[model samples]
Target: MSFSITLVIIIITALISWRAFQDNDLKYKMMFYPYNVKHHKEGYRFLSYMVVHADLMHLFFNMFVLYNFGQVMEYMLDFKYGSSLGTFHYLILYIAGGLFATLWPMSKNADNPNYLSLGASGAVSSVFFAYILWNPGATLNLIILPFWDIPAWLLGIAYLAYEYFMAKKGTSNIGHDAHFGGAVFGILYVLLINFEKGQAFISYIFN
Candidate 1:
């Protein structure tokens, strides 16, 4: 059987998040607190935050997305670049997506000592977007309305628009900024790694 890095990540994240749920200190230490990241040298939170979640639902959603999209991404990468290099790129996409997702929040909330964020939403968003880029014609059903299947590219556009709007509105606790940032990173990363794929993606969407 082929090795599955996505499953490994989900297992590790689930274990850590489960333990953190019972330990406030662990959660706090692992959460993405921009204030501490700026004031103190707790830069590890940038990556560590992906391993914890505010609740079971949050963990399940992020991991579920990661599990579905991430496996697809892994297979695509391996098919394109072979096993070793593909795994490396997958790691880069996930880790860098998480790191990139924190940039805007870190800058905007650095002074707000109460600001806190957690979960693998950013990383999962990256994988989801990357999947859309490669499979633009694929049908994606809304979780709430699963019967209505939307084209992957159209869903991507709506998702980005909603995230941008929500981030600007700043009324919700959800990290819309991170979602947008991670998605952008995903698309850009895929394009950079394979410019030909970008051309194919455009043609698939338009023609």
Candidate 2:
């Protein structure tokens, strides 16, 4: 059987998040603290923050989304680029997505020592948005409105708009900037690798 990178990432993230839940100091160190990154040279937090979470729900939601969308993305990439190169791109999409997601927050909060964020939502968003590109016609149901099946492309648009609005509002503790950034990165990364997919996605939306 071929190894599953998506499963491996979930397991690793779950274990680390579970342990961090029991250790405050560990979570603190793993969190993305922009000021610390700027002043204390703790650049590792860009990636480390993804292994920790604010709570069980946060971890579960991120991992659950990743598990579903990531598997599809993995298969699609492997089919298009072969297993080895595909796996490399998947890792780049995920890790770089997480790193890119923090760019806005890092720039905005670099001077504020109290700013801290943690979770894999950014990376997971990358996976989810990439899946949407491949399956724009797929139906998506929100947890709050389970009965209303939304088209994947529509959901992606709504998700991005909400994140942008919330990020601009800057009133919530949630990392809206990361979600927005990761999603955009996901779309662009897939388009960059497979320009034809972007054309197909546009056609799917219009016709």
Models 1 onward score TM values of 0.97, 0.97
Candidate 2 minimal-lDDT segment of 10 residues = 1-10
RMSD in angstroms, all models? 1.0, 1.1
CA lDDT for candidate 2: 0.92
* Cα shift from native, residue 32, model 1 (Å): 0.5
lDDT (0 to 1) per candidate = 0.93, 0.92
Model 2 / residue 125 / CA error / Å? 0.5
Compared with the true structure, what per-residue lDDT tens digits does model 2 show for residues 86-118? 999999999999998999999999999888999
Count: clashes, candidate 1: 0
lDDT of 1 by residue, 1-207 (tens): 188999999999999999999999999999999999989989999999999999999999999889988998999999999999999999999999999999999989999998899999998998889899988789977779889988989989999999999998999999999999999999999998998878998998778
- What TM-score does model 1 achieve against the real structure? 0.97
- lDDT of candidate 2 at residue 61, scale 0 to 100: 90
What value does the lDDT take at residue 75 in candidate 2? 86
